[model samples]
Target: MIRRFRLAAVLIATTAVALPGCDRPPEEDTAARPPAPTQNADQPLELTTDSGAPLESRRGEWRDALRALLAAPDADTLATADRRWRDLYDAFNRHYLSLAAQACAGDRQAPLQRLDAWPLYPAYVDALPAWPDSGIVNDPALELSAASLRRQQGATADGEVALGFQPIRLLIAGAKGAPRQAKDLRAEGDEPAAALRERRRTYLKLAADQLQADLNALDRDDGLSLTSLRCALETLDDRLAALQTHRQATAPEEGLYIPSVSVEILEETQPKAALTQLSADANRDARAALESGYPGFQTALDQAVEEDSWAPLGEWLHAHGD
Candidate 1:
């Protein structure tokens, strides 16, 4: 029973392995071995007891199993060592959902404790790598991989956090590189058609990561602390503004001009594409608000250009004046 319970505990900890796009190293990979099959063939994804008992057979058996294993003295210290980690994992999901609520255009504010609690969140999130026996029945990684596979009907989900921006990337790259024929522009510049789409995809992914960092900081709720949120908004505004300006500058030269397309792309692309629906909405709103701030920023930038008052803007951007 102790050995079996230990197995069960391993299974529970393995659930975190299900997070998509997070590839564990070979030695640390969860699912390093075959997992024991659960009782129900129809519900392969269902949690199971260490003894291969179906977790759903009893009232809240899954949680009960977790509680019991956590309380056990002799079960295995390895299980106990991850106690706080698991608790924090559960907390992160809840908090992540809650923070999603705060994502809106103008007044995004997650509760203060959530933000304050964020720095501690990564330790718990990152610790999933350390859990033992990932390929076991209790392995979360196997379930996640299975789930992701199931989700796309055997197609791998790229862990995309926003609309695939390969199109935009391709378009931009073609424009940046030596001028191509109109036919080539449409053919090769189209994200889906471009051979270099992967590179653009990479850039979009990096941008998404940057946006996520901003979201994480905003959600880091140290008592509804607006400092980071404000900074995030400001950063987003600057990026959007720069993007807008770049689009403006390049539009005439590209011969493929569409301000609306640029606007749409800027509006739709965001950091939290793979999160829960609520969190995604929150992020959308936050992004919108950030975008809304752009008008003022654009005006400021425009005035700087119009008056040739580069000194103030330059000084503001640089720590020192020439």
Candidate 2:
């Protein structure tokens, strides 16, 4: 069963907040500044799986592809990375994430899962018409520091996320509604402009590093329980229901990752064929874990999939019992 759910659509709550000033201009001795980290284009990216074979996790594949894209950023690589992200997002939402949530529910050592699925706000990562120079790219305070990047996540009153896939998206895609050129990223103009360009490049590198770090954190068995997988599912269901109501009342802001929202609506309005596949996949994985002598695997999964406010899971089970 191949369950391909679309990536979750993010809801952006807007607010009127004062923008900060750009980072102070670089010092006169620009040569003293540390060079941005560089990756060797010739080196192959290393990806390891639990079985020590080809990588099977979509998340791992996306991470590697993203690394490659960051190493030699170009239009083609950016497109490839975006495709990989979509694949990862779909697989995670439909199957792997559920499994992780269930595991976390039953075990104390389970990896921590993101509750909101790290939704991206384009305005938080890049400049939008209403808030030009509003994102991490233009903010000198966030430039070139992993700590700063991590600290800024969910630190705003308006729920603007400072880290994650969206910042990387803007890094590769340029500003919100503009074509990115090679020259735009290069430091080729006069002193002030060139310094800004250099800062942008440095920020891009830092953003990619921070992204990779976040992904790595998800793989750690750090005694972090993300509560029951059912909680996450129920939360998502509520969000989807609210989204539908919001759309009916008033149109959502345009250009806010509309494709992802559209995909969610399509899944909701369509048949439950995908849900069957998802159930089968979940069952198979649970059995496999049990066969490998993992205690309580089946029990945990059974509890996780129990009927709740998650409409799709409930409807599917009502139509077809486990």
Candidate 3:
């Protein structure tokens, strides 16, 4: 049976504002962002399981899956590879990525973590209902290069995403409600359409390559300690609390990508099983770290674990009947 951590009583709160020209909005205030977590630099940790398989191993697996997907010869092959890549991506996000982010907080690698999890808007990468001619796919003025893509990674207003996984998803899966076929991406028998098709394929490869590079950077280090774990939990708690606040003020479609991704990860598993497993893993690691010498982390860890800081997210998902 799937289990959940008991929902926390006090949720993290944040203010949300609507962005012009888009239905969804991004978080506005950064003043309440948590302070950089403290880590014991002298004692570097190697996060792994009993079998000694490092957390970054999953990143390598994901990179392999991505390469397979890009090299797919036909629609059928692409579809199969796509599903496999997505499953690995979801698993990595739910388990390893966040932990790595916490472990590397305030380190030089912190920027890489943010780039990997950057907010993505579907419209920025491909066409959407509101903006049919939107995204880099349709815009001929924008060059299809890594440098060009990097420059377009952020949003000028709210609810707009120019880069990241969502863009990659849009490029691979086609536009929302309108999936692309192998023929659609093939450059043949046309002027504008042919050029567009070629551009589409180019964008997909570049994005995937960029994503793999970031993942490789992150995989280089797997050192985490009790302090890092505590930081991870607190960050999660803050995110859940912010999600709770945002849910009250807007519709599900209008919420932030972080919450949406969090819900999607939970949904990928059986109801609450993913979160239950996540908490279990955190607690297990926390115990191991505590035994090694971090004494003061117990109070915070107990509060975070006991409250099941992610309960509010589950509640929000259920409320929307998602």
Candidate 4:
């Protein structure tokens, strides 16, 4: 099952570790989770490991590392934001896609197994303008998942829920809603639901711990390749484009995932303002690198212009290359 708490912690894992009476073995012990990728003194930090479970299994590990970098007291990443860009891209991609895949797995109800009585979900439903009839709401397997949002507890008219990453994302992002029920972790049945839920929490914490340790061991390599820098520039351009498109097309009250996901949900922060600010920050960070040397700069500039990417940036960089 996959569960996220206020967007800060999302845990998705399978099984309880050995119970004297249970057939299922204990959850995989993470004590030996892979060590951090070895340092490449030539670059900031290794973005990924050569060997691991697919991106799905290693995301939390990466997020922890990335989060630590962001929190580092040394502000040196400012000079080499390309590395941060690289890390953010991998972390964002892995996080967005993997959570959906892992949580929606196995009966599609797996993610919701533990949310049976969580409090915030009901409030989340009552407030929706109108449920999206995206077919996801009607899945039989999600009956229990939707029941958690039953507004009136037993009301048949409660809002329907689709298989969504947004609600969970909102949860993780420190949105207003939070789990209210007492979580039980005792190993109950041979295949106890309780055990898996507990294991998810344990697993998530371990993954976070692992990531932090990796971050502490990593160092910034100022000599990233030209190609890597160009890639980072393009990534920021892509994100800005997509986000602008979404913001323009989405309605204000729709809870549509970003910017306007509601100040109510955000509590203290403004994601809308922050998105624009981040794009600007990333652009500034990449500017020096993007404009670094001459002929290579022209080639990178040409690619940006040819692709019709954030044209203003391309034109500006092309006009000012050293």
Deviation (Å) of 53 in candidate 2: 15
Better of 2 and 4 by TM-score: 2
lDDT of 1 at 22: 11
Off by over 4 Å in 3: 1-42, 49-73, 97-119, 155-159, 225-227, 238-262, 266-322
Residue 20 displacement in candidate 4 (angstroms): 46
State each model's C-alpha RMSD to the native.
25.2, 16.3, 10.8, 18.3
User: lDDT values of the candidates?
Assistant: 0.28, 0.43, 0.48, 0.29
Give the C-alpha miss distance for residue 143 in model 1, angstroms. 30
Instruction: Put down candidate 1 lDDT per residue, 1-322, tens digits, no spaces.
Output: 1110122343223322111111221223333322222322122111111212221232133234334432442334324323322332333333332333233212442222212110011111111122322111122332223233223221221111112121222222222333222232222455434633233233323332332343455343333212223333233333333344444433322222223333343334321211122124334443333224322323433444555443323223222211
Tell me, by TM-score, which candidate is best.
3
lDDT of 2: 0.43
> How do the residues 15-47 of candidate 4 rate in per-residue lDDT, one tens digit apiece?
111001011112334232222223321232112
Q: Write the per-residue lDDT of candidate 2 for residues 221-249, one digit (tens) a residue.
A: 33212123323333333334434433332
What RMSD does model 3 have?
10.8
lDDT of 1 at 160: 13
The order by descending TM-score is 3, 2, 4, 1
Candidate 1 Cα misplacement greater than 4 A, ranges: 1-224, 249-260, 265-322
